[model samples]
Target: MQALYDVPAPAKLNLFLHVVGKRPDGYHLLQSIFTLIDWADTLHFERRGDGRLARHDGADAMAELPEDDLCLRAARLLRTESGDAALGANIHLEKRLPAGAGMGGGSSDAASTLLALNRLWGLNWPLARLLPLGLKLGADVPFFLGGRNAFVEGIGEILHPVDLPAQTYFVLKPPTSIATQEIFSSPLLARSKSVAIVAGFPAHNSSDDKNESLQSTGAEVVKLDAQGVAKLCGGFGSNDLQKPAEAICPEVRQALQLLEARYGNSRMTGSGSAVFARVSSEEKDGMSNQSMATMLQDLPGAWTGKICRGLDRHPLSGWA
Candidate 1:
């Protein structure tokens, strides 16, 4: 195919992020459930035989996108890795997701670029081949390439696919942005002991034996179905970075308070300023688009909000 149009790069929400430890290299080890949501940025790609790669801003594009955008990085990396200097693409990105919101927007876009270009160039490289290349771009890139809800660990490279229940979430993005480096480098950030999870989350304070925690949780973990996954939503675990992120961007705190008051449970996703709340599927079903619109009417004029649903798989799951 010479062209791919309107390809999707979906965003992700961290159900819960816990800093388990730090590597000798200073990279933090973490455990979290990275769940895909319907909110996405769109990309269009056209193969260029002349071997010239270019990027364009689509509707609502972010202002001042860096010259070395992830899409370009991904394309160049793929070309270099595949040894196909003749391969090139013109990529147009529709930047819907807010940067620095901990939504994995850029990483997702990069992953999508790799997937689309592989097919365009007839590389037909399997996901395993693409994964290492993706890792070089960013920690979260592999998760998007894996294309499923996953239990992620080890600076976001390790992924174990988990079936997540279908559910809707109210995702709110404050005007302010929080840098991931800032949160990770903060002296005040909490590095918690790894929390164990089975089919369900145990009480937050449980102190079970580490070996037993893994063994007992292992069987039940594999057996967890959609209903089981749904129960864990808004109930288990917490974001370790939330406090630090809120301190850095007060709007994060304000957004969380607003959602928590209405939705009972809300937390910052990934490392920053965007927060999400679990909304009942039934409640969402009963409401019209206009009703959903009014739900966020009270949000600050500078902020943006969306009612998004969790996806079992990324839209490009089978492409690799």
Candidate 2:
């Protein structure tokens, strides 16, 4: 195929994040469940025979992006790593997910770029082969490359696949963006000493038998089925970064308050500036899209909000 059109780069939510420990290298050790969502960025690719890589803003959403955007960087990295200088592509990104919202947008786009180019360039590299290159781009890149809901650890290089139930969420993004580096470096940021056990979380202990197993194993078991997973997530865990994010940006707190007022429970996803609340099945079943929109009619015009459904796997999960 000479082109790949309407390729999806899905976003992710850290259902729960914990700063279990800090590495000697200054990287923080974490435990989080990374779940894919319906919200995504669209990408289109056309093969170039001249081996010249180029990028364009398909939707004008990426007009300000630099030449070193993750998508382009991924392309260059793959080309160099594969030693295929003759392979080239014209990439157009339809940016949808907001940048710096801790939604894993850039990382997802980079992962999708790698996956698409793997096909368009005829390299056919497996996910395993591309993983190290992806890690070089960002910590979240490897999770997106994995294409499944995962229990992530060790500065995000380690991943253990976990099945999650299909569910809906209301994700709200405020006008302001929080710099991840700023949040990480903040003196006010909480360095949580309490390590989280997978079984101690709601989604991880959905069944009595599973709870029994966890108790017997001292919460060492780490895998769960889809139903159990669905029961486990959806505003289930805390984000250790939320306090610092709010301290840096009041908009983050505003978004959380708004979502919490409606949904009763809300938490910041990833780092900051974006907050989400789980829409219970009973509520989702009773409300239509129009009704849902009406409920959120009072949201600030400057803010962006969407009702998103969680995905079991990445759209391009099998592509690699």
**Tens-digit lDDT track for model 1 on 168-200?**
899999988887899988887887665555443
- What is the Cα-based lDDT of residue 230 in candidate 1? 47
- Per-residue lDDT of 1-320 in model 2, one digit per residue for the tens? 89999999999988778776777888887777788999999999999887678788766432334657899899989999888788888899888999778999999999999999999888998889999999999999999999888878778988877766677889999989998889889998776535555543334212233221211111323455444444444334478899899999998998888877877768788996888887778888999878977866767877888899999888898888
Clashing pairs in 2: 203-232
Q: Point out the worst 10-residue segment of candidate 1 by lDDT.
A: 211-220
In model 1, pairs of residues that clash are none
* Top candidate by TM-score: 1
Candidate topping lDDT = 1
Superposition TM-score, candidate 1 onto the true structure: 0.89
